[model samples]
Target: MLLLLLLQQLLLLLRLLLLMLLLLMLLLLLLLLLLQLLILLQQLLILLLLLLLPLLLILLLLVLQLLQLLQQLLLLLLLLSLLLLLMLLLLLLLLLLQLLLLQQLIILLLLLLMLLLLMLLLLLLLLQLLLLLLQLLILLLLLLLPLLLILLLLLLLLLLLLQLLLLLQQQLLPQLLVVLVLLLHCYCFYYYS
Candidate 1:
């Protein structure tokens, strides 16, 4: 009985260890997911930086063209042309900035779509891991079934042996006594001769 109790405790401990391993695997998967998210965020930031380079170059060219045009203007038309040029430059800057914003929006939309796709892929991988865990659990159970059956058979055999001993005490004791008496008589007869 004590041995059986100890065996049950050992089985419980093994189950707890398996559960801990499962928890660790889940935590590792979460860490992997977080790392993937960080990587995606970094990629989108890089794409945004790359997209901004052309807009910066366009601004620099516009500034240089304005400087060259200013040097060619006369003092008489300077005041009038200065106001017109300022207005035109402001309008052009606003238009260019709007276009840049639109392009950024389109890039952001693309990034969002890519993020969605990545998330879907991650979800599929997680599902696959879960399925593998379930399969492992089923296999472990299958392996344990024969061991359980064997233990049950051993317990039944032990019970049968105990019952057989009880039967001997109750029904075979008198026959055993008669055999011992016969053996004792033969030994005495041989000793006398």
Candidate 2:
């Protein structure tokens, strides 16, 4: 009966040792898979940056083009206003030659002055519109700045994590290898004995 119990305990120890080795192998595999996942994430992030570069550049070009077009429109409006003023002046000179009454002359002059004031108001409104556009551009830059900074930070951190995982492998790999060798040796001795 004592021999049987000793035999059972021996079997149990061998079984437990085998279970431990299996668990260690599984743990090692899982750790390796995690390392691979982190590496994949890093590669994907790099690819995204490469793809996004051209898109960001195109957006910047579009903004510059918009600003240029706005300036050209403002110039055209100013030129048009100048042409209208010259035409009005010519008409008034004609009226003078045609012996228009003093009262009519006064009315024409007042009308021209009112038109000038309206043009000035329109110019002010256009200036305000331009200011608003500038403000919007600044706001967009402000928003984009943080996002770009965050992406940069994330990339940096991921790189650091990859290095850390490598370091962990360097530190623990030999120990795990030793443990596996020792367990195999013990199992072999037990089977032979």
Candidate 3:
């Protein structure tokens, strides 16, 4: 009877050991499945990131192109404005040159009128003085005839000298060359800027 009771206890222990081994195997299977699912989730996230990278690069490229176009447009506008300013400056220069020419012409006209008046006054005075001398010579003909003849020759010589002086003009080629050089220098300055 005792042997039979011992055999029953051994069989119960064996059954309990077999049940524990089965539960361990099931736990291991569940852990392996959970690990595979985690790996798949990681792969899916990596694929999503890969698909989005090219789109982000394309957006960045578009933005850069837009910025470049804006920069070129701004540069073109600046150049156009500068060209307009240059045209305005050239027009102003032309107007200034016209005004200067008009002023110079007016001054020349005034100078010509003053010289003419001076020559006329000198001639009138010389004629009046000669008439007075002739009257004196008539009053004392014997003493003053030779003196009056010499004075008449001197008067003729003086008139010839005044005529020669009046015909001569001041030289102005040097001043004109200086003005041309200054205009060229100003043009170069603006072109380089």
Tell me the spans in candidate 1 whose CA falls farther than 4 Å from its real position: 74-193
lDDT of 3 by residue, 1-193 (tens): 9999999899767766655554565556556556655665576567556655655665565566556555655655665566567556655655675777766665556556656755665576566557555644543553344455456556755664564344322222343354455455545544553
Give the Cα lDDT of each candidate.
0.59, 0.70, 0.57
Pairs that clash in candidate 1: none
Please list the residue runs of candidate 2 whose C-alpha ends up more than 4 Å from where it truly belongs after superposition. Answer: 100-193
True-vs-predicted CA distance for residue 176, candidate 2, Å: 20
Clashes of each: 0, 0, 0
Please give the range of 10 consecutive residues that has the lowest summed lDDT in model 2.
Answer: 93-102
lDDT of 2 by residue, 1-193 (tens): 9999999999888877876776677567668757766775787678668756755765676678668757866865786687678667866765675575557667667668767866786797678678767866875775576577568767866776787678668855665676677667656766764
* lDDT per residue (tens digit) for residues 1-193 in model 1: 9999999899777766655665565556556556655665576567556655654565565556455444533432454555557556655655675777766665556556656755665576566557556655655565565566557656755665676567557655654565555456545544553
- Which candidate has the top score in lDDT? 2
Candidate 2 overall lDDT versus native: 0.70
TM-score of each: 0.36, 0.51, 0.42
Give the CA lDDT, 0 to 100, for residue 94 in model 1. 55
Better candidate by lDDT, 1 or 3? 1
